[model samples]
Target chain A: MRLFLLAAAVFALPVTALAQEADAPLELPPVVMSTEHPGEVAVEPYDRSNAHAGATPFEGTAMLEAFHGVEGIGRVVDAMIDLSIEDPRIAGTFVSHDMVRLRRVLKEQFAYILGAPVDYSGRDMATSHRDIGLQAADMGALVENLQIAMDREGVDFRAQNRFLAKLAPMKDDVVTR
Target chain B: MRHCQSIGVVASLIVATLAGPASAQMFDWVPESRAGGKLLLTGGVSTIEGSGGGGLATWAVTSGYGAEDGIGGNVHATYVNLPDYELRSWGAAASFWDRVEVSVARQEFDTGATGALLGLGSGFTFTQDIVGVKVKVLGDAVYDQDSWLPQVAVGVQHKSNDQGAIIAAVGGRDDEGTEVYVAATKLFLAQSLLVSGAVRWTDANQTGLLGFGGDRNDDVEPQFEGSVGYLLNRNLVVGAEYRTKPDNLGFAGEDDWFDVYAAYALNRHLSVTAAWVDLGSIATFEDQRGLYLSLQVGF
Candidate 1:
């Protein structure tokens, strides 16, 4: 009876632990050799710069105000990422990826590009998407999701297009396939 | 009994681990089968001549919502009601990989009371068929925002008019001909504007409804088409187009075509276009101006 109990306990151990892990936040533990954002997985070491945002920021705060500042930018990024992760055309690209870090970096990148008070600290576009094998169609899917997210945020259509124009040049770097 | 329990526990542990990874594998990154990915209005509306473009000018954009990894096609019907004549056309176009486009169209030019005045009976109709192919040569109009270079394409259109006797009576040299063109298109997203231009070499008189070449001019001449559009929103674009036509027939003068137009996408699969167009004159009838309406359905 004791031996059976011991075996049962052994079997229950990892299962219980896995259930707990599933309930916990998905942030991975940081690696020892890299700069880490809170609640984000460690990434390979690379020089980080605002230039990693891949586009020049607008000249004035009007664009930032149109996006409702960094807070709105955060919401937009989160919604866009969530939609894209759920979209059948593009959800596969987000699978098994470190979404926590992606959400944070995308928020920063969008805030910086919209002329908000933020600096992007992420890898450049080409380096970040190096292995994703994104085609023009994939990029188009993401853009559609982003548009929906922005529309939900009540951003003016013209303002949204102006913002998209700034990001459009990065297609060369993002669509490697 | 203890040995059995131990083995069962080992198996359960193995199952748990395998199941964890399997759940993580719920969504696999399948590399194939992506479609319907082009942005709204990026494909442009079908033209009267059966290519993708503004109402009159042929832009370099392909025919449908297909992106580089997919296929898209559409069918369109257009009608132009002029003062002295009515023109109707229906066509279909398909795009592959956003690289190649194939299209076919049929046009009917009907002269109402003007046919009786010209002594060709009342309600005379000239029918023509066009088949065209366009290949995207380089660049992307929508995505390449940093560059001034526009998306460019080369195309050929073969036209056959059915009224051979009437064409010869109008001093036409042939009832069939071929036209070649090069087109460039660009979208300035910041300015919410799109621009396109094409140069066509053709001897087709009145776009081949009156037939190809003529007694006065039997040589194909270069003609220009230009369009400029401003995007009002994601689904609406307002533009103007100008197209120069060859005056090959000695018996009648041909005039350039122009239109101020608006195109709206009801969704990715459907769109409508309306314009006020001026075709100047048809045959000996002068001041042919009226409404142009077109309907397109596709994906």
Candidate 2:
């Protein structure tokens, strides 16, 4: 039926933006199993095995350098705080707070987390914000602000996700509400 | 009447998709502990052979992007119009925790004019039902993006043909058999690419159309299926698949299956896939190539 054929149009639109006619082909990595003779599965946790002793970093620290420097960290903090307060979900919470202190503390915290050079002497995050009456929405707003800040800082998507993955674990300890 | 019914089903599906969930609440059901519906197009569309894959190969991904302890599923209807035959199938599958998946599909293979030439009644149809289950064995295809680890799974498909009498008359060994396969799938997020490979031990003739095994070869053999997918965008996937099949019945030669497809996920709830499929030959017909279209809706 003509009606059925019409559904194909969805893919036809913006044809020019799709991948090129030819794409780079993918090849399967070589097999590493029983070459001539091997054995069965005696699997254990990697950390409990001898392989754990040889832990090595596959990548370098050059990626974290983007969030380095006083100017970069300042801009990053400014973007995060500015957007966080501007977000309606969290705006009321920051109204009576000292903006200067929050900014300084956040900068120090981020610097510490990213392994940059900064001295932050604020109470631990969980203890400091425990009475703020934060909700899931507030945490979401914070993540949104952080992601937007990373984008404004020209951090590529992959790098942003990588950094976020490291920071993502803090949600459990920070959000008791 | 059946044609009208099928169309009505599709029409109702479209309405349900539009009225169901707004984009903001798409992943709201997932717990805050895990990010669900974050992976882009991880669940490849249902294949012609009634499993979750590109066109023929089965990927290790458990059919959806639902995170740990979450659930996901979809319903799909596919129609393939080839030069010598027409095929249509309806199926549904669900994945839990991205670990286990179960699916069922009913396939109709219409041997139109070719049926009369072979002394069968006009529009002779070969029908079959396929039920499949797969369990993820290892690795994370998406989250482990920085590593070379690929997700792997082992699965089984039990297929039953309705035309047992006619199938045996064509020299087929049986009308029911199970296919065992192991598949590995990997997603390279940075490169926006996905690759999958599968090895299946089967003796089904033309995927159990004429039936399983035959006078020519009765032993089970290893066949290969492979696929490569390119993420044109977060919602769009273009891929190609290749599946080498078994040649059981000496009545006709079976060629490998190939297809190039583009799958578009309008949102987390609805998707459509269209492809050009080539299932080389069937019976005495040669070059049975055609177009395939499928639609899927789910959370």
Candidate 3:
């Protein structure tokens, strides 16, 4: 009897409504859970699809906000640097690295690329690593580490791609081998 | 005779390309082949009229294998069979500088038994030759998937029907006409979806088979076409298209066209498309519906 009731409820949903429900949260997380007033009963899991307009998380400003200001960008760069040093493919490049200086440059580069007002005054990509043998494998490692850091930071997938698109061109300057 | 010569040239080109050391088709498995910056499936299927589009509507994508800074070309053969009519077509298209496309197609429309009703012999057919050119004027459909701006193009198709005598006898005022169209197509990567819409200004009746205008209506009218496609996987795309057409002939009413289709890329060299199509009415025949199959091989 319980199974029958469950099946009945599932079948009762209009296909369009079910489609909207499935895709709505998959694109943008609207309401995981919400409660404002405790005095009266509150509607848990509110439907806010129409409540917001032109504020999709994919907008440039919204994407920039996901980094949680300069602090979060710093954390992302730190994670990437840490992961790069652990990966066997590019670990040797970081063996003699100055962690503090690299972190600051990465933060500035990311901040400028993500639409922050800050200017990146660090050395151009080639000038900074002129002697290092940056091979294709090293570039691959850098990309993988950056991806992992973005995932850890809870950055929206679209925002991660937007950031990576700007960095992809740097490969020409960095990867000589 | 001219049509036969054109067919021979296109057929020879297809064979020569297939047998050559170079593969003109975009083979995704060989990523190095696309050093010129083109990607797989960005070149859409050939429309029935021989432009880059879905089954029935023209899209904004450039045709053939050419990418950002090169030239690419391809040939296609399409067959459509309905309850009372059939259409066979062959064409070749080329994309240059990844911005402009030019194509030519020859269509043979078999009236079947309906020819007998029109006082023409059974199995009588009408033929037309079409020349088309499109110029990409805006955004990139593939790389700009993260944004809402779609790729846009504007084009024109000039069609000339061969059976001028029969066409005039059936109330058609002219044997030739041109279609001017503007189309936009976009790809949304996250949802694996592609949607396109186009508006066209045309005066042709039965896609110019029975010819343009008539004693009934002599002016060009605007029509619309749209498509929605979903990628089931990298190798296949399933979609549906609808195109509105004008009814300028007083002899019989015309209905809009629609199709649901699946297109599969076997490799860059070849792809096959099959669709269930509804063309509404042809001549005086009612409720025309059938299967559409097309085979395209390219480099």
Candidate 4:
């Protein structure tokens, strides 16, 4: 009888302690959302369908992936270079002797847009453009060309604007004649 | 028999401890009966008055602490961008026992003005220090689930412009004046909307630290502020807001304005927001529209 009572008390101790701790405020787990594809759905109660049903779809990760991959990046880079060459204004502003530097800038920008792991280590945009003499007209043209490139890749307008917001602050630095 | 008595005594003591002041104090912070401890961050741009006038479009970051029932506080920093000058302000606030809030802020306006206006060459700067207090007189915006009336609060911001020479040159009356205001704010949880309206009574000429001169009677004018947001998930909110201001200064006409904004809660510790503002013209200054963006990280 004595042994059974002792065993019962020992067993009850952990349960009671757990009950008290459970009553306290437990830390909430970090919420993670799916980034696999634009159409992928998350499981509920982790689902945000009702809350974010109206959100602009996620496109940055996929776009970044396309830039990182050899074939996709090659095609996009060729198109960008071809467009720049065809447009004298773009050619004047983007005049670079180092193809490697240009490629690296493009890669860094893609990574930023895709929320990937990358840091931009290029020359300061303002200092580089100090001698180029870009006007508002040139800025407008650059936006248009970027828009065309985004459209070719099926990027939505809102998502494109989100990306542009990150780049807009550079205007102050880049447009100083 | 002695062991049983000892167990009984221990149980009684535990029950007594559970019913003591410690437990009661814990309950006070639990946010029960109130939607407490919500950290709110907000900013917008508008004309200082209701007509066409050029005022600084502002971007601010603020964070609220504690519960609606108990003591709460907030700290904010603002940057105002103008055509010729830039103003920066930092402030801290405290709300005591959930009934009163007191705040203090310091401002610096630098124009880098050279060869302009009264031999006050480049590096001409204007500074102001403001002290504010607010009291919640009636109504609750969040917890009174059955009512439509929002949380109504009355507050005052007293400003002391440090530019004594400018005030003297402009023939201003007092370097210090109080702006007393009443505001009503509501949160529509279902629609993810926040609406607010306010009226301010003040003697200060402009919302800017530069005191308004001339024969202007201390008058009360109605100001309105409202926001409608769409929750793009729990972490992201896309919204718009419109706020009105009193045209205390007669130099330029003040016109109210509106903004479209989007905010993403990166986590509990960080948030990023962007806004497109259409600030109505100040007097002859048309197209006072611009973009405002801000990022906030908190613990």
Candidate 5:
């Protein structure tokens, strides 16, 4: 039957590819269309894990609720991005970058780290910022913008600091230049 | 060649005038237009010794609002009214790249009416000048929150007193000396607390205003300075400081200093600090407690 022929071909495809890989190396393109997020571009496929969030999530739902759940996290991320793109000190760094992807990944990262019931699918810090040419002062400017966003969302100062403490260590991986 | 030299001199003069009075020709070296990216109060207020810190202790922070890429500077004036003496200090400090600090301070310690009682006449004053350089050697206190390691710095201060004859007559061995210190500071953001400690090696009596070394001690000794601060808000911090001093003078015993202070930043460019200080003993006078007030302004 035609269905049996199709199934046989589907099973044989992987065997053919494995035989080719044994004979030579596969040359994968560096960037490709993101099959997971249609509108975003992605690098060569990698595993998706909560470890990509860079910091461990808080133990309970208290931190999540303090940030007003996922909605508040989304607002803070958007505002931080908007402010950073306009801020003269670091605006140039954001130019020509994939902001669409940045916004989604950042929102997911923040929500996941704040103890939301969500997993991050973004690249690790070192991989994402490898070519940004960032400096220590650029990180400072970003933190300032983030603080402004959190302040506007009515987050308590102590709670804000607790979250900042989590992200502080990521500077080692984020500031490559 | 003479004509070309004259033209070059004229061009330099014009550029200097356009750069303003405070920073003439500085633009020639610094082309970066941006300045002041640091968070508020992160530079700390100017210390009595003109370094960045609390009232009596020198912290590991740089002296200004400059970020890691820019430059910042400040000038401060401090006055202390004590039971037996009055102390006035004024100074300026500049931080470059938030890595190195240079500062200069002048202290005038007036005997006031106590001068007459000590047979030195009224208003007899001892003056001293201190030049200091501090270089940050390790982590950052503000940003490195996840680690227990603190920001550390090492500094040297050279001090010279004007009254060498009076110092020698009072059992002091020298009027000029140098001090070296290492300071460590940390900010526990989760608790809104800051802690700083320092150890200085010196033989100065009364912080070199009464001169260095003395008949009783001529060797450099290590003394400790510590501070603890609690942040009430973004603009306000309350703290206490304790500093130990060497008892090098045979004529009078030197005691440790203590202060409880409050510092408030009105904005990025201006701040005020007030404290109740206990200087312990000066000369033969004891229980020398007083009010301390200081004002700082910068970029």
Candidate 6:
């Protein structure tokens, strides 16, 4: 009987320890624990959670301010339009019709630049110029005029070039003469 | 024994040294011109090189936008400087799925008849309307994970001279023609460069808009265009391109031209570009040099 009790004690001790272990919180892989879902098995909170929750103050507001800084783009757009009209190089190229188009185009351009909701409904550029004889020299003048306008607006040279690069493919259609 | 140990150590050291850098360099051949779901604004001045007998040099500005999912559109305006005349043009384009693009444009080439050649005096305008379509047959220049060849595309431009009566009087045949072209473009990310090359075949006469007045056989000639650029950063690129135009004139040959250009990206929403060009000559005229600049803004 004493021997049985000794064996029973050993077995009971092991079972009790196992039950305690089963109730204990689990230690998961770092990635798995880091991505803990609400429905996942409960786990002991790691120290990292304290650091994660202690995010910088006003982070959302800071981001909003940074975005608002781009609002200056409106001034740049206005400057561009003014420069187009004031600069003789580009001004000479514009017809009365082009001026009307310019106003609408600049307005839409600024709205989009400022991340405002807008849709462009301007006439097709090619169709508009069908009657006007365009020469390569004219294209050169227009390009120079644009550069001057950009320069006045404080647009960096590299930023200006990025904008120009997107327009290169239209040479085939635009240079009809 | 010491020598063997030294060799083993050296081998391990070498392996360690190469492993990290090799893994880093594994992404070299991937194409960088991916569809970023934002508008792409590109423009430049290009001269017709020496391919089309002799032609005039010109400057042009163009703008384009890419929709969120590979759908996009573009527009362009250009001016050409001739010795005795000036020309102007504008165009627009739409791209679908980044695999196909269609465009329609108009051009007006004015020849001031100062010299007493034809009874018509100065202000003789040659106008043309063009419809174009391009389809990518193979390769994606912007999204190849690993490849050396650039993105290849085939396209066609159909031109119709709006001044049919004027063209007919000048001995033109219907004032319409078709031009077919194939182009390839690639961006070298490590070098911050983009390169494009193209060959075009056309049935248009030298009097591009005027058509052929004589019984000249339609010439199917190959034209070439190429661009080389240095990327300043992710948003800005400055480049140069050389384009060869087809000589459509049966008489009074034309000379080709080339352009040097610079471009800038303002943000995800806007960009601009400028270029200086040398348009060789049209027929006997010379000294056709000019500049081009444009601005583009999109969502």
Which candidate do you rate higher for TM-score, 4 or 6? 6
Worst 10 residues of 6 chain A by lDDT: A49-58
Note the DockQ of each predicted structure.
Answer: 0.56, 0.05, 0.03, 0.01, 0.38, 0.02
Off by over 4 Å in 4: A1-177, B1-36, B39-63, B68-74, B96-98, B114-120, B216-230, B248-251, B278-287, B293-299
lDDT of 1 at B294: 93
Docking class of 2: incorrect
Q: Is the docking of candidate 6 incorrect, acceptable, medium or high quality?
A: incorrect
The digit string of per-residue lDDT tens for model 6 on B1-299 reads 23533543464344334323342243234322212232233322212210100112211111133321233443444455555656555454555544566666556666777333444466666777777777767753433313576666777667777667755654455677777777676654334466777776754544265553333444567767666777665456676767675554454455555767666666433445566766566544566667655433222
What ranking of all candidate models by lDDT puts the best one first? 1, 5, 3, 2, 4, 6
Error of 4 at B107 (Å): 2.3
Candidate 3, which segments miss by more than 4 Å at Cα? A1-177, B1-36
* Tens digit of per-residue lDDT, candidate 3, span A1-177: 001122233444565465774555323222222144222222233223211111122335665687776777888999999898887656877653445446765777777666666555455676556667665435645776786898898886656655654555465567555
> lDDT by residue for model 5 over B30-105, one digit each (tens)?
7552356577788888888889999789999998777776676777778899999999887778888889999988
Candidate 1 Cα misplacement greater than 4 A, ranges: A1-36, B1-33
For model 4 the TM-score comes to 0.47
Across residues A1-177, which tens digit of lDDT does each residue of candidate 2 receive? 001112134344356347546565433233233332243112221222212111122144444576645567678889988988787656866764546556765666665555554445445555556666655345545766786787788766665555554454455445565
Lowest lDDT 10-residue stretch of candidate 5 chain A: A1-10
Query: Order of all candidates by DockQ, from best down to worst?
Result: 1, 5, 2, 3, 6, 4
What lDDT does each candidate get? 0.85, 0.70, 0.73, 0.48, 0.83, 0.47
TM-score of chain B of each: 0.89, 0.90, 0.91, 0.67, 0.90, 0.69
DockQ head-to-head 1 vs 2, winner: 1
List TM-score per model, in order.
0.85, 0.66, 0.63, 0.47, 0.83, 0.49
Q: Which stretches of candidate 5 lie over 4 Å from their true place?
A: A1-44, B1-34
